[model samples]
Target: MSEKNHQGKRTARQRLAVEREKQKASERRRRTLIVAATVVCVLGLAAVIGLLAANSGKSSKSSTGPVVAPSGAQGKDSLAIPVGQDGAKSTLTVWEDFRCPACKAFEAVYRPTLRELTGSGKLRVEYHLVRLIDGNLGGTGSLRAANAAACAQDAGKFPAYHDVLFENQPAETDDAYADNNKLVQLAGKVSGLDTPAFTKCVKDGTHDGWVDKSHQAFQAGGFSGTPTVLLNGKDILKDRTMTPAKLKQMVEAADKG
Candidate 1:
């Protein structure tokens, strides 16, 4: 009888040990699952942060600051056109399309010289905004952007808005039609524009006549491509060869003539 009782106690103890081990195994599995889930969440958060940082960097590099004249002419004249002294003896009228990459490049290179000339009273620069690439690339954003610029000109914010547009113009693709809201946002980036009026003008096509007039003039002038500069309404420069030094020399020669 004593032997039987000993066997029963031993079996009970063995069963309890097995149950304890099972419980331990379950706890370990739970901990492993929790750690894996935590790792996944952390990795996702890191990826999101990295993406945002990259986007922020691109935005900063793309549009740095307000366009300023070159350092040498600091106190002599305001870099902003029309407000500066018209030092130029000859008038330079430029007809450009906002979507034209060549026009943007020209602006990048010649903006400073133009500003300096305008400031020094050596030239009077007039920009006639035209929508040459409206329906072809990105629907009407290109045209809408041009009209917005004219609105800015009316508000005396042409220089600022013009610089901003060239700075922010998208690639030649269908994705460039971002909507009128984007146009308003871009106009707001310019310093002196009246936002409400500018928005209204862009939406209602307030300056369509200006664009039409510019188109007529461009057609009359035989401008097949952009970056066309007319010095006193005569074609003087066409493409990449129109450097600042060359432009200065041309202007000086024209003055002599």
Candidate 2:
């Protein structure tokens, strides 16, 4: 073969080899991208499964039937009394569980706005204590605390005792049984409460039936969670994200209606 032809053939072979190497590099990159995408999808699915599991554990069954207010044997208008009043045309009632962290958070965030509205007569706020966490958080202790607050209400000390309980909620993982002494201490902190009577009521479960009645009322009202607020007998806020700003907007809209 001519030297020129031979040299040209060698060059052609080198060029083909370089092209093959380029093709292999492209294939490797494509495979890497596929694996990366598959891993991301798997991670995303796992995250979704975890979220669903968490929510399922917390979800409660909501009642779809008509709501029945508490019986007159308890008291007339017992379900509708204003725990706090600003004489606003609208009434905002909240159903809460003392052991619920979300209820504590809602109280912390909305107390100021609630005080502003109710104190100024622009709103009337009533709180109904529910016992959702009785089994998990503090069983009897949780129920006892709620019942104690009811006794305070009987003695017209609801607001003070209510504030104290939320302010001093035990650590999240602290069992509800740990709250008994603290609840008694809180009752004592509320001036004007019949301390001895309140103590006896809590210890002897004087208000246990009342607490159960309140929970029944909450279930009747279609609530399945703490911090459920009813604005003027109409269900309004149910989500934990119902912030003060959102509540204020709700009140304003209700006023317009």
Candidate 3:
């Protein structure tokens, strides 16, 4: 071959090599851009998903709307439903859940003594409703019953209705109180308690926020369980030897003091 032709062919091959390298570099840049875009999209989608999850968690954990305390409710934030004379000398604070079997047991044992003391104006009871069972058992019975009790409180029959609930409490795992109709039917046992307004309050969940707030406070207080009975800021049930007679004696002593 002629020397000029051979040199021409060599030059042509060099140009081809340079062109192939430029195309390879271009392809690499395009692939890098696609990978970067995919990562950004995935990160953005992850961020949106995280935001939704956070909002859902907040909605489930926090109470919504205004807390409507029961009529005649007294105490910090009006979370307590008072059941006796305000001028009574001693205060009995009861943290309880209606669906709790232990609470029903406590009420069954102490109701007589409490009634007697409160009747004589020697003791006042501050009942704080909680929904611990609802949280533990995956049902709304505790919340519904507490709200119904608050409704009865509004009707000025809290003490009577409270006793009725405990006396007729269903099994702990029954979750029967979740039915508003059943609660209203039970109200029929209390004379002058099953009014239209009371029914509406029970069914509409009027005091749900107040009950939830009280439950939150109970949780924050680090209490271990339900039917937490306190007398003048002392945990009476912790004594393990506490009885109705003992509770009466303590209240009388406080009154005398």
> Which number leads on lDDT?
3
True-structure RMSD, every candidate? 26.0, 19.2, 28.4
Model 3, span 58-171: residue lDDT tens: 654446346899999989989999877899889999998887776776776678899999999999999999887776555888899999999998999988888888888887
Per-residue error at 225 for model 3, in Å?
A: 0.6
* Candidate 2 wrongly placed segments (more than 4 Å): 1-77, 177-179, 233-235, 238-242, 252-257
Assess candidate 3 and give its lDDT. Answer: 0.80
If scored against the real structure, what TM-score would every candidate get? 0.61, 0.62, 0.76
lDDT of 3 at 98: 86
Model 1 stretches with alpha carbons more than 4 Å out: 1-87, 175-178, 238-241, 252-257
Model 1: per-residue lDDT, tens digit, 1-257? Answer: 69999999999999999999997676455434433433422332343344446776454221212322221212212221243445557778776777766677667657887887666666777666555555334256555676677667767777888888889977745435347777788866767565677788767766555454454455455554555677777765533244565676766676676
Clashing pairs in 1: 86-121, 87-120, 87-121, 87-122, 87-123, 88-121, 88-122, 88-123, 89-122
Q: For residues 1-257, write the lDDT of model 2, one tens digit per residue.
A: 99999999999999999999997676455434433433422332333344446777763332222233322212333643355444577787787766666667657656888888777667888777766665443345556667777667666677788888878776545655345566777776777774787777666656566666676576556554555667777655434344566678877776677
TM-score order, best first, reads: 3, 2, 1
Number of the candidate with higher lDDT, 1 or 3: 3
Question: Model 3 — which ten-residue stretch has the worst lDDT?
Answer: 37-46
Better of 1 and 2 by lDDT: 2
* Candidate whose TM-score is highest: 3
